[model samples]
Target: MKYRSRTDIFASILQSANSNKGVGITTIMYKSFLSHYQLKKYLSIMLENDLIKLEEDEHLYRITEKGLRFLQLFSNINELIDTTKEYNV
Candidate 1:
């Protein structure tokens, strides 16, 4: 895998959350190709920033409206950058 910027990582994580009704940590980890520690670190930042929310009852993470916007902007930027849009690459 090529080096991924934090923005790329954030976008990857958010994409995982958005595609599912609700996603668990393991699912996010696999989808985002993150380690447990990295997942914890990024998820904490995302939760604190209100980009994602945890449903305690379900033990699942869901994307916030802000996260959707972020993904939109990320897509726009990727279009301009002409980077690969392939997931799980």
Candidate 2:
């Protein structure tokens, strides 16, 4: 399998969490194909950066508006890169 960059991983995590109403840490890890340690580290950073919010009552995580915006921007950037590569620019 091709290696994924941190931005790609973050985008995957955010996309997974956004799709689910109340997503658990393990669920995100499994869906994102990340190990426990890696999930924990990324989750912490996402929470701290306001990309994802944790629900204390249910212990579930949800993506925020900012996170959605980040995903959109990331997708656009990736598309731009691909387009450039296609033209050998």
lDDT of each: 0.93, 0.89
Model 2: residue 56 alpha-carbon error in angstroms: 1.3
Off by over 4 Å in 1: 84-89
Q: lDDT for model 2, please.
A: 0.89
lDDT of 2 by residue, 1-89 (tens): 56888888999999989955779988898899999999999999998999999998999999999999999999899877764344533
Count backbone clashes in candidate 1.
0
How many clashing residue pairs, candidate 2? 0
Candidate with top lDDT is 1
Q: Please state the error at residue 71 of candidate 2 in Å.
A: 0.5
Task: Report the alpha-carbon TM-score of model 1 versus the true structure.
Answer: 0.90
TM-score of 2: 0.86
Give the residue spans of candidate 2 off by over 4 A.
Answer: 83-89
Candidate 2, poorest ten consecutive residues by summed lDDT: 80-89
